[model samples]
Target: MSYTVALFRSILFWIAFFVMSSISSIGGVIALPISHRGTIFFVRIWAQAHRIFCRFLLGQTIVVEGEMPDIPVLYVFKHESAFETVEQPMLFKHPAVFAKEELFSIPVWGQAARFYGLIPVDRDGGGKAMRAMLGAAKAALAAGRPLVLFAEGTRVPHGEAPQLRPGFAGMYRLLGIPVIPVAVNSGLAFPPRRWVKWPGTITYRIGETIPAGLPREEAEARVRVAINALNPPEALLESN
Candidate 1:
């Protein structure tokens, strides 16, 4: 039964993916670059649509444990499932991610990403991407937009422990915004890699913000501690 259900969700997800990609691609090419509002609207719609799809199509539920702050914060979410594209904006209402420039090469979605004031980086571009994230995040905070960065650049399969990029820790020195560390165990329940998955509750735990304007090391340590606290006894992830 789970296999049948997972397959059904996968089918629906693929269709949605293509449809969303087509819309974003078409939109991206037509405009070349959209305004920040355009980016926010795209993400808002995409997030909302995913929430609906998850509940109706995937049989998933999310519970919020801590208070989601009103101010534009830096939300450091756990990278477990590809489903985060849905979770970030829907749960927090403020979704400004530090994404890859490759995404901007897509279509309307990419254009929207540019307009939404998202930070686009290049992995091959050395420290360039990290620099963009710092600057973009500050700009967004100034404009009253919360920043969302998945410390781990890409989504990892279930049981694959979260491996974080080094730059995320630097935000402690650069951005004076609140830090909301999130711990989600979606990989264990709705394993996207598997054709058949169990029907289980998806945990989305959000921690309080790390103190702002601390010295670089302190800030970095604070953020590290916050994330590490997400999974007690689990050590800071080693670089791959």
Candidate 2:
């Protein structure tokens, strides 16, 4: 009976998700003729609903401990689950995110992201895409929108992280803004293992906002330190 109920709930959640997504898409289309800010507001609402839907689908909840920065600045979010990509903005006010270029080609969805100020990337270390990310960061800084980046270039497997990518260091160096280092235990909530189905809580640990004007290498190192302070490998298993 529990299994049957879970299946029924999943079906209900998916139906609602499709309906809400269509409404969000319609909101974007309606905003095409209006102000960009309107579109951003619409997108934010859509993103919140989407995250809520994710919780419903997987029986998960996100708890972001600690206060976010009050000033407009750069936000360094740990990339683990797909949640960061969709729900990061909900945690920041008018945040500008760096994303892979392929995401920008996802039909109407991509267009809405572009409208909401997503910066797409090439992913080959650094080139025009890197420059574009820096440029977007600068614009966000100038316009007082928070800039968010993933230190990991791609999603690392649960309980296994390789190393911080170079682009994260490069962007921190060029931006010259304070970095609010955030660590997420999304993998515990949604394990990275293949075909895993259990659901749990995702805890977001927002560490002390590190002053971001440090040298390129130092800034990157500082971000890593803050992330590690949240959870070590030993504690990760208990969370899972």
Candidate 3:
């Protein structure tokens, strides 16, 4: 698609997405004081609706290449852009995400995130912060909710493979559950640091699950390879 047309569609999608987010945030806020489940229910609907808008308006559709586990597992996703983050709640049932603490500071959205059982990670804080995050994660695991995490910690541009962050290893050893590593090419369709949304399919390839009980370094290595399976092998070598 031409840049002009892509730009227009991207703008329209963003406007609709944010408007829906605001409306959903209101619903989440109202349900927050009453029922946490009700808040999550509204949020999931919002995420699905956003996907629909992207499908019809921006000509983008998500194609899942592998099956998502029926039971709760630690999900380590390749963070290429906001696309997966927007689709996450819709993809899993009542998933507990480890999002940056700063995201939980947003007005109504922040409050709703906390009530929805989203764990906050204080990146710059020391051991205390990690402990607090792990504590929250354990609670989520006990509740049987899938833990969604970005192994790279933040968005890495398309085609770049970064080493898995230190926290991922910590969680793997502590959580002691199967880890599902997901790779996505969302950045190609919805490129980061740009407004133009390309008309293409955003592929999410779920690699084989890595079982728990491995040493921290070994587990991290396996996850890094799994989540970057879609990337070139040279990229993986360079990242290491």
TM-score of each: 0.79, 0.84, 0.96
Question: Which candidate comes out best when scored by lDDT?
Answer: 3
lDDT ranking from best candidate downward? 3, 2, 1
Superposed Cα deviation of residue 25, candidate 2 (Å): 2.5
> For model 1, where is the 10-residue window of minimal lDDT?
231-240
- Model 1 regions lying over 4 Å from their true place: 24-39, 126-131, 158-163, 192-198, 213-225, 228-240
lDDT of 1 by residue, 1-240 (tens): 557767877678657756775665455344445454455556666667766666677677776667767568888877767676556667655557777779878645666567656688676776776776677778778877777877777776544445457667677556766677877667765665664444567776767668677666666555555544534353454421
**Whose lDDT is higher: candidate 1's or candidate 3's?**
3
Evaluate model 3: give its lDDT.
0.87
Tens-digit lDDT string for candidate 3 (88-120): 887888888899999998999998888888899
State which candidate, 1 or 3, has the greater TM-score. 3
Which lDDT tens digits does candidate 2 get at residues 1-240?
A: 265665666566668767886777678767877878777877788778877876867687878788886466777777766767768668777888888889878777778888878878778756776777777778878888887878777775455545578877777677767788888767765545433333567777888877866877677667876664545665434433
**Model with the higher TM-score, candidate 1 or 2:** 2
Model 3 alpha-carbon drift over 4 Å, by segment: none
The number of clashing residue pairs in each candidate reads 9, 0, 0
Model 1: per-residue Cα lDDT at residue 223? 54
TM-score of 2: 0.84
Candidate lDDT scores, in order, read: 0.66, 0.72, 0.87
